[model samples]
Target: MPRVVKPKDVRRAEVLDRALALFLERGYENVSLNDLLAVSGTSKGAFYHYFPSKEALVVALAQRSAGEAFEVLRPVFDQPGKNALERLNAGLAASYQVKLGMGVPEPIAAMRSLLMPENQALFRKIVTIWEDLFRPVLTEVITQGVREGVFDTFDPEGVGDMIQGFAASIQDYLVRMFDAADAKSRRKTIDDCVKRLKLYGIATDRILGLPDGATVVLERKQVEAMMTLFMPSRPAGSLP
Candidate 1:
């Protein structure tokens, strides 16, 4: 029989799948183009066809990861009999949960692996991709909230943008928290970050003209859970 050929999309997906496995097993920055070729079983030309550059791979993986994340979150926007407020709450909670679960794990440890100092640029890239991807989802919910009189906003789109900004604001805090030098420093960083999250929750309520404590952007419990889930404390005397 003649050689069977895979469709372009199939081949592209295979490369990405292989890449994701490599990324998860060994952090993204550690995996070189040659490494990808060897593991993905694709030639340099073929890999370049799918990803023009290593950074291109980051973009592709970010898009795919963000897409996967949205799939998990899509249901929250379609729940039966859920009011705008209810959906907003559920949606926010679910989004955090999905992220904490590292569901696609940072649009593909696109978030988790980005934690290392070397992957800072890649981390920033994925964050932008995620914000852009999810902005419309939040806008829709905000618009609906306005329609149902659950949220008070004259410009839901702008509010949606602001929410994305607020969420992105935590990125630096998280980096600092994770990079803390010692147990005491880490504990302080965590506390400060968690407090900032709580404040953001309140700010969200104010933005929507709700009561002082209407929304819970990132609950303390959720923060703690995510911290434990994603970056557990290194064992004493363990390498960083």
Candidate 2:
């Protein structure tokens, strides 16, 4: 057989997923280009064709994470027969359900790996992916809120930036939560995370001129579900 040619998208996704699985398990910095190529079964030139550099490859993974999150949020934001306030609240809950420590094993592993201190630069790149993918759509929703007289912002873009900045500032706490050494410390960090989320929601309401409880940026039960991921794994052969 003349060499079988996979569709470009299929081949690229195959290489990407396989290589990313390796990176997640091995840690990104521990895996070199040759290692990625070996695990992915692609030649150097072929890997270069799909990803210009190692950084680009990991950036794509970050984009995939953000893309998954937005996919969950976008429909809620765009739901028919829903006003901006309703849609915004729904989107916020939906995102809280999926992102954070949402129990999807791959993303949890990927996040843990990326948030490693050695991967700080890569984590920063991922943050940009999230911001780029999140901001414009939110600005549109903010515009909708303004048009509906549901919000009191003259500049939807500025308010949107403020919301994103507030959310980003809380990210350091998340890193600390992941870094917590013991179950008690992790539990405390989780509480701090929840309080920060509540504060951010309140800030959003104030910025948009809605009542303090108007925006549902997070919910108690949903966060309770997400926090289970941070619980230290039980020792082997211990209580279930």
Candidate 3:
């Protein structure tokens, strides 16, 4: 027979899931503990036991969501056979899928909110966690690509930052439009951005002349990593 689960565990998970949903649907300020209680069917005491306050709960929710996302993505980057660039591009694709699946809204909203003076230190801390995770792998890939004559010259760290900035902007746009049900258009924008990114700095010669599946393994690995790595944070801006 299967083992039975505890009620508190079930309640905690339910409360979190419901809270996450509400936070996503309504901006953080708009959603209340009472709202979560109504949706989760849990007592205030139970909610407090799991999450001390609304702000603390939201913070926990953000951290937990981001953590879950990372677990899903880390494997792609960790794959041994994949080359760096292939992983990078594939990561972008996987990221889009995760966003769609998780129903995440515009990330910039969260980023901006997290940047508020009150949250800035924590925001920076989380940003550092993120940078620590992606920077080494990304830098290694770019550095190796340069050494192997696979890429034209660019600073590895700078390139990494550029990629992150670019992806963040694209995600922000995707989420805002997602709320409008303009996913198709949002996807088109992403495709265009990818094409532009490839053209701007990536070696056209390497990609243009490569045989089919040359990049498949790495791309898949990247996509997997990105799926887990990227996710929504606190809502920063007011809703549109």
Q: Who wins the TM-score comparison?
A: 2
Model 2 clash count equals 0
Q: Which residue window of length 10 is worst by lDDT in model 1? A: 231-240
CA displacement after TM-score superposition, residue 151 of candidate 2 (Å): 0.3
What lDDT tens digits, residue by residue, belong to model 1 across residues 128-233?
A: 8887887887888888888888899898888878777877787776677576777677667668877888788788898898997787577655555555545655
Candidate 3, residue 232: Cα displacement in angstroms equals 22
Per model, how many backbone clashes are there? 2, 0, 9
Per-model lDDT: 0.76, 0.75, 0.54
RMSD of each: 3.8, 3.3, 9.8
lDDT of 2 by residue, 146-221 (tens): 9999998888888877776776666576578666677677667667777888888898899899999898765545
Off by over 4 Å in 2: 100-102, 219-221, 232-240
Off by over 4 Å in 1: 1-4, 21-32, 102-110, 233-240
Candidate 3's error at 2, in angstroms?
20
Candidate 2 is scored at a TM of 0.85
For residues 1-240, what per-residue lDDT tens digits would candidate 3 score against the true structure? 997656876767778778756655565556767898898876888778888887676666656655665676667656677666666556655655553444344553454345344454444445455555667666776676677666555677766666555544443433333343344553454455455444433443343233333332223233223322332321312111
Sorting all predicted structures by TM-score, with the top scorer first, yields 2, 1, 3
Instruction: Report lDDT (Cα) of residue 43, candidate 3.
Output: 81
Candidate 3 has what TM-score? 0.54
